[model samples]
Target: MLRTMPLTKNLTLEQINHLIDTGHAFISPFGLNRTAYIVINHKPFMVVVTDVSINAIQLSGSWYNWDELEKMGGVFESEFEALKAVAGGA
Candidate 1:
């Protein structure tokens, strides 16, 4: 569980951003309104990005394999900026 996993505590903003930017799964279309996931962790944490203009971001969705994120670019700097701009808008 999250309480037992030390990695959860090690999770940093930079790391989270990196995971979003270059992660195996990039920002893809989610719904008719251009929704997509920007997170790379299997801990019920999913960063949702909608209305890129406002840069709305939110963490929702079920848990997935965090390791999967490493397989991709592993994250990017832009993702960090966007996430902060919207404060991961819910």
Candidate 2:
């Protein structure tokens, strides 16, 4: 499946991180599925459903898998919680 339409517009790394940190970023519904914008080492990345049935997520434009994402810094319920997790070294 060719996806011409971008899931999100071109946002700078700082903008993306700001959105995530400020709790503006969210898991947006996409064609009955969902997508999330994540930041790793100040780099913006997207995680989207590859298989709804299995509740799988694939890093957009990259081969990095879910495990890698978890290792980098898994998704949290809220940005605040994520910040706490990092602070506490969780």
Candidate 3:
């Protein structure tokens, strides 16, 4: 249970640029367009970039951070996949 999940990390410059370069479009659970970023937190998470704010999901507690950039996202999932579509793009 991801009770009161924390917004402990913010996207770094490197991570942000990488996301802008490789962020893949995905349909949110709400069926809107969003971009997905693989965030390297204590564990790996799928961060969904929306027009208003970013949302994240920890899929099965797996950890996978990209490159020299050390960044983090959030937790849990009942929403749709944000990490799925971008697995190969980055």
User: Which candidate achieves the best lDDT against the true structure?
Assistant: 2
Whichever of 1 and 3 has more lDDT, that candidate is 1
Model 1 TM-score (2 dp)? 0.21
For candidate 1, the lDDT comes to 0.38
Which ranges in model 2 have alpha carbons more than 4 Å from their true place?
1-39, 42-55, 59-64
| TM-score versus the correct structure, for each prediction | 0.21, 0.35, 0.18
Query: Per-residue lDDT of 1-90 in model 1, one digit per residue for the tens?
Result: 333222355788887687668753244323323334343342222344332211232223333233444342222234553354345442
Which residue runs does candidate 1 get wrong by more than 4 Å?
1-59, 75-90
Q: Which stretches of candidate 3 lie over 4 Å from their true place?
A: 1-32, 52-90
Find the candidate with the highest TM-score and give its number: 2
Error of 3 at 87 (Å): 14
**Global local distance difference test of model 2:** 0.52
If both were scored by lDDT, which would come out higher, candidate 2 or candidate 3? Answer: 2
Worst 10 residues of 1 by lDDT: 50-59
lDDT-based ranking = 2, 1, 3
lDDT of 3 at 89: 26
